[model samples]
Target: MLSIEGLRVEVEGKEILKGLDLEVNAGEVHAIMGPNGSGKSTLAHVLAGREGYQISGGKLRYLGLDLQELEIEERAHAGIFLAMQYPVELPGVNNMIFLREALNAIRRARGEPEIDALGFMKQVRDKARELNLDEKLLKRSVNAGFSGGEKKRNEVLQMAMLAPKLAILDETDSGLDIDALRIVADGVNLLRSPERALILVTHYQRLLDYIQPDRVHVLAAGRIVRSGGRELALELEEKGYGWLSEEAAA
Candidate 1:
């Protein structure tokens, strides 16, 4: 469903992603494990169409459309979802209002009519219940006064509502207890389908325990160095990324 070829990206005149190539087919989940500064988050930002990341070279195709040609909103409307690692706080925007606006924006982009307030509220309630999120959270400001776990849950709620064809989660398992992680994982697992693909960017293998991936890749220095099955994750957890880096250098 998604294909990238020889993608090289740079930010602030510094190259981050160098000759990165990946392909994710429908009904598959791929995990990208890498150490810090390995361009994992950079790949997510570039795919999301965030500004300031200069595409030095290569191509990104999403379901046959040229991803690099689309804007961030366009990507979102095209059924591409990104769960950010750090969700920003919007003090003035009520969570419900923000979500409604986002949903409407996406709907409008797809030539769909805007949903009424009541209908939107019902959808929010239903999604929140499915994700194990509290209804009160919808009434509060976006990420304002929310705990770390709450922020992560809010991200998952957005994913559930958006129902993207390809979901790219950047460190969704960070800063969460086991219980919170399970809830977040459940939200992701529920979204899996034959027509959808998932790319999980993580540092540890703990999150893999909840949501098993079809393939595991170890990325180092902006490139994939090792591709293996689920067992590779366990080995990395036991031995650490240093060995992988050395292997990549070799």
Candidate 2:
């Protein structure tokens, strides 16, 4: 579903991604594990085509199209959904309004008719209930005055509604307690299907316990140095990144 080769990116005149290569197939869940400053988030940002990150060299393709040629919203409309580590709060923009507009925007881009307000609300409300989100939460402005857990749950809610082909989650488990984590995980699991893929970037193995990614990757010094199965996450958690980085250097 996604292919990246020699993906090098620089930010603020400093190189972050040296030469990262990764591929995520359809119906697969890939986890990227790295310590701080390993460029995990950088890869996510570049993939989504965020502004200001210079692509010094590399090729990224999604569904066989050159991803570098697409705009941020274009990438999103093409089924790339990024659940940010920090959910931005949009004051004065009601959550339901934001969701409807987003859904309609994607629909318009696809040349499909926009869903009526009633239908969109029903879909959002049903998914929110299944995700165990409070209906009131959906009525509030996007991430406005929300707790950490609330923000994360909101991100998952958007994902559930959007149903992107490739969902990139950057540290979705960063601030959640066990209960909130499970709530978020349940939403993610519900969204999993044979047609879509998930890329989970995390530092710990606990989230992997519930999700059980098909593949795990260790990124160091702005590149993916090691790739393995589920056990790799366990090994990294037990031994720490130093061991993995040394192994990569060797």
Best by lDDT: 1
Give the least accurate 10-residue stretch of model 1, judged by summed lDDT. Answer: 158-167
Give the whole-model CA lDDT for all candidates, comma-separated. 0.93, 0.92
lDDT of 2: 0.92
Candidate 2 regions exceeding 4 Å error are none
Where does candidate 2 have its weakest 10-residue lDDT segment?
241-250
What is the lDDT, from 0 to 100, of the residue 236 in candidate 2?
Answer: 86
Give the per-residue lDDT of model 1 (tens digit) for 143-176: 9998889999999999888788999999999999
